[model samples]
Target chain A: MLLTDLVQELGLTPLTPQLPLDEAAGIERAYVSDLLSDVMGNAPGDGVLITVQVHANVVAVASLAAQKAIIFAMNRRPDENTCLKAAEEGIHLFSSSLPAFEIAGMLYRNGVRSLKE
Target chain B: MQLSTIISALGARVFVNHNSDTCEIDHIFAGDRMSDLLGAVSEQMLIVTHLSNQGMIRLIELMDASAICLLNGTPPCPELQEAAENAGTPLIVSPFGMYESCGIIYSLFKEDTSSL
Candidate 1:
């Protein structure tokens, strides 16, 4: 599904619109982790990342992984400075009140799958 | 997704990267030992560890990771943060401990056939 579709359907708060909304690429896989190494060692490129980490480094990791978007769970938001940097990088970011587990369920229902399996 | 987005998900604290340069992550590799990171090569990877210091930053720089996550609520000093910014490596400090952070990450990223 398109990112905009996911946002509209799931009611996720959009932090940045840097990424192209129409592309279906990188939307299927969803990786959620706070551990940066697990993400680097295993997460498949492209797809949205779900986690509670709100920092600039998160932006770097997402960019390198070629992820399509980032969904911050638990109603947590990144600081203003981080958001500005993300906007500069052309990365689309979103915030959700739902926790990771619920978000995963919502994603699965919406046709999103994991890249690892 | 841009590296910035992960910051949102992790609720991580950004120590540097004022320019917000667009960066993508290919994958993630978690390990505290620098030696382990050196042995592997991947595209745009994120390094997760509990260590936060100049040595850790050096390891990240050598690994060419897109970003670094400092777990256990440990904060890197200003010098290390500066090094990361100069190196163009994003740095973040997580509130949770390393193991908890890893577990949280694993739950969301790990998938089963049901999602399929």
Candidate 2:
């Protein structure tokens, strides 16, 4: 699904509004994890990440994992510096009131799949 | 789902079995971060993670999780095994990677809910 479509469908609030959402980039898969190591090793490239981690290191790991966007579940938001770094790295950041599991389920029902699928 | 069913589904080896054959798991929380696991874990949740350490054993004890399944065939260290044995927590080693392990368990969950 398109990043914009996801944001609208999930009612996610953009953290880095300065960076425009990519129209051509479609997220086909998503990985839900708060572990940076797991995300780095297992997350699909160019896919979305659903996590509750708000630390600055999330940006570095997401960038390394080649994630196009990150949705921080449970209304968790990173600091301004982290958001700035994510924007600089071209990774979109969003916040949602729903928890990670619910977010993952919603995405799954909407045709997003796990990496193996 | 029973812990035994999950072990068989993943072709996992049981290193520390504590009534896992009949133990029922109602949820699956797959992650490597303890902090995330702490917040997400619910009753009868089976934790599927790549981390095999004393911390994991402690988490199982603290949260009273049904079981802990380590992925990628990674064996738990002697200390971790001892901890699990002492705490009576089931420890399993899955031959598949994290993604595949979660996928298999997710399919089981989907089937379970579909039947309801």
User: Which of the numbered candidates is closest to the native, going by highest lDDT?
Assistant: 2
lDDT of 1 by residue, B1-116 (tens): 45565566667787876433476654555554455456544667666765676677677566666777786566788887877887778787766544345444444445422322
Q: Which ten residues in a row have the lowest lDDT in candidate 1 chain B?
A: B107-116
Provide the lDDT at B41 for model 2. Answer: 76
Candidate 1 on A1-117: residue-level lDDT in tens? 777778887798888755556664437777666556666665567777877777678888877777767888777788887777777767788999875545755676666666454
TM-score (chain B) of candidate 1: 0.78
Where model 2 places Cα greater than 4 Å from the true spot, the runs are A8-11, A98-117, B39-42, B96-100, B114-116
* Reference-based TM-score of each model: 0.48, 0.78
**Lowest-scoring 10 consecutive residues by lDDT in candidate 2 chain B?**
B107-116
Using TM-score as the measure, the top candidate is 2
lDDT (C-alpha) at residue A3 in model 2? 85
CAPRI category for model 1: incorrect
i-RMS, every candidate?
9.1, 3.6
